[model samples]
Target: MGRKKNQAMSVAETDREFVLGAAARLFRQKGFDKTTVKEIAEACGMLPGSLHYRYPSKESILVDLMRLALEQASGSLSEAIKGECDPLEQVRLGINAHLELLVGGSDKVYVLLFEWRSLHGASRQEMIDLRDRYELLWSAMLKSLSSQGLIRADVDRDLLRLIGLGALNWVATWFNEDGRYTVKDIGDFVWAVIKDGVIKR
Candidate 1:
C-alpha cells in the first residue's frame, strides 16, 4: 500500500511539473500579464479545472517559476566560484556563470526578470527574499575586496555592488546566445572595465 501511494504521489508530481513547463513556454511567448490560467491549461492539454487544482492561479505558477529560476541561478554562481580566492576573479566567474545560466534557461529567466512587477503581496516579498540571498553572494565578494584594499575604501560598498551587479544583471536584456562573443567573452569584456577601475594597482 505504501509503495502504491508513493507511485500515485510521483504521478501527481510529474503532472505538476508538466503544467509548470507548459506555463513557462506560454509565459515566455506572452508576457506574464497577458497569460491566463486557461491558456496554460490549453497548452498543457489538461482541463482548466485540473490545472487550477494544481496551481490555483496563474500568479502562483509564476511565483514558483521565479523561485526555481533564482534558486538555480544562485546555485550556478556558487558552484562556479567554489575554492576560488581572488575576489575580482570570483566576480568575473560569477558574472560568466550567471550569463550562461540565464541563456541556458532563458524562458524561465525571462519570466523572472520581466514579470517581477506583476507579483503582489506575499508572493512579491517571497521572491524578494530569495533574490536578496543571491545578491548577498556579490555583496560578500565586494566586501572581501574592500578588506584587502583592492577597491576604494571610501566608496559605499552597497552602491558599488549596485552598479557592478546592476551592469552584470542587465546582460539578460541584450545578450545573444548565437552571437560571436561567447557568454564568457562577454563576462571578460565587462570585467575588463570593472577590474581596471577597482583593482588596486
Candidate 2:
C-alpha cells in the first residue's frame, strides 16, 4: 500500500512539473497579460480544451509557475546553506545559486518575477506570500551575518536584500552567455558591492 501511494505521489509530481514548465515558457515568451490558455495548450501539444482538465484557468497556471519557481529557489538556497557555517560564504553561495537560476531559467524566472501580479484576488495574494517567504530567507541570512559581525555594521539588511534580488532579477533582461561577464562573474561582482560597498578598501 505504501509503495503504491509513493508511486501515485511521484506521478502527480511529474504531471504538475509538466504543466508548470509549459506555462513558464509561454508566460516568459508572451508575458502573462498576452499568454492565454489556448496558447499554453498549443505549446504543450494538447488540444485547447485539454488545458482545462489540468488547470482551472490561466491564472491557475501562473500561480503554479510562480510556486514552482519559488520552490526551486528555496531548494537551491537550502542546499547552499547546508554544511556551511560561515555566514559570508553562505551569502555568496546564495547569490551564486540565484544568478545561476536567473541565467539558466531566465524565461521562467522572468515570468515569476515580473508577471506574477497579473494573477487576481486570492491567487495574486498567495503568490505574493510565497515570493515574500523566499525573499525573507535571503533577508534572514543577511541579518544573521550582520549579527555575527561578518557584514558591515552600517549595512541595512533590507536594502542589501533588495539590491541582491534586484540585481539578479535584471539578468534575464541583459544577460548573454556570450557576453563579457559569465554568470558567476556577475554574481561575484554583485556580491562584492553588496558585501564591501563601492568605496575602496
Candidate 3:
C-alpha cells in the first residue's frame, strides 16, 4: 500500500481543523463543563494522548474555540460593512451580518455564545477581553453614526451598543431553520425597530 495519507495528517492542518470542529460539536452537545478531553479525542477519532499533546487541557480547547468564534463573527461584520459609507445602511448590513451568524456560522461560534461561562481565572478574562475588543468595533461605528447626526442626538450610543447586541444575541436562543421567520426576516425586523426608535428622524 502507498504511504497512508492519514498517517501524516496527525500533525497537519487536517488534524487541527478536525479536532477543533469535533470539539466544537461536543461542546455544544454536552456543554463545555461536562465534556471531557478524552471524549473530544474520541470525537476527533484520535487518541487522547495525541489530543493532550496539542491542547494539554479541556479549557485550552474551549479558549481556542471561543477565539475562533470571535474571529468569525468580527470578520463577518467587518466584511458586511466594508465599502458602505451610508451610516444607516452600514448599521443595517452590520445587523444582518450578526444575525447570519446564528444560522450560517460554525458550531464554535454557537459555543462561544452559550459556553463562555465555562472558563475561569485567566482564561475567563482572556475571553472577556477579546469579547470587549470585538464590541469596540461596533462601538466606534455607532459613535461615528451619532456624531454624523444619523442616530438620534439623545440616544446613548453605549446603551445602544449593549442593548442592541443583547437583542441580537438573544435570537440564537429561539431561532430555528424551520421557524416562521427566515434570517432575512429577523434582520429586517430588527433593523426596522432600530431605525424607528433609535435613528434620528
Candidate 4:
C-alpha cells in the first residue's frame, strides 16, 4: 500500500512539472494575461478540466512558476559563491550565475520579469520575499567589500545594491542568445565597469 502511494505521488509530481513547463513556454510566448487555461491544458496534452485538478486557476500556476524561477536563480547564486572569500570574485561569480540563469532559463525568468503586474496579494508578496533573499546575498557581498576597503566607504550600500542588481536584471531585455557575447562575457563586462568604478585603486 505504501509503495502504491509513493508511485501515485511521483506521478502527480511529474504531471505538475509538465504543466509548469508548458505554462512557462505559453506565458513567455503569449504573455501571462493572454495565455489561457485551455492553451496550457493543450500544451500539456491534458483536458482543461484535468489541468484544473492540477492547478485551480491560471494565476495559481503563474505564481508557482515565478516562485520557481526566483528559487532557481537564488540557488544558482548561492552555489556560485560557495567557499569564495574574495569579495570581487564573489561579485563576478554572482554576475555570471545570474546572467546564466536568465539565459539558460529564459522561459521561466521571462515569466518572473514580465508578469509582475499580473500577480496580486499573497502571491506577489511571496515572490518579493524570495527576491529579497536573493538580493541579500549581494547585500552581504557588498558590505564585505566595503569593510575590506575594496569598495568606496562612502557608497550607500542600498543604492549600490540597487544599481548592481538593476543593471544585471536588465540583461534579459536586450541580450541576444546568438550574439557575440556569451553569459560569462556579459558578466565580465559588467564586473569590469563595477570594479573599476568602485574598487579602491
**Candidate 3 worst ten-residue window by lDDT:** 1-10
Looking at candidate 4, what is the lDDT of residue 64? 86
Error of 2 at 61 (Å): 0.9
Clashes of 3: 0
Each model's Cα RMSD:
2.8, 2.3, 4.4, 2.3
Query: How well does each candidate superpose onto the true structure, as a TM-score?
Result: 0.86, 0.90, 0.90, 0.89
Poorest 10 consecutive residues by lDDT, candidate 1: 101-110
Residue lDDT tens for model 1, 98-170: 7787667567777888888889999999999999999999899888888888887567888877887667668
Two-way TM-score contest, 1 vs 3, winner: 3
Between candidates 2 and 4, the one scoring higher on lDDT is 4
For residue 2, give model 1's deviation from the true position in Å: 11
Off by over 4 Å in 2: 198-201
Residues 1-201, candidate 2: write the lDDT tens digits: 999999999999997888778888877777888988888888778997878987888888888888888898898888878898887788889888888888885466778878856878899899879989999888888877777767766667788677768768888788888899998888878777765672223
Task: Give lDDT per model, in order.
Answer: 0.83, 0.81, 0.87, 0.87
| Model 3 regions more than 4 Å off | 1-14
Which tens-of-lDDT digit does each residue in 49-144 have in candidate 4? 988986788999998888778877888899999999888899888889888887775688888888999998998898899889989988999888
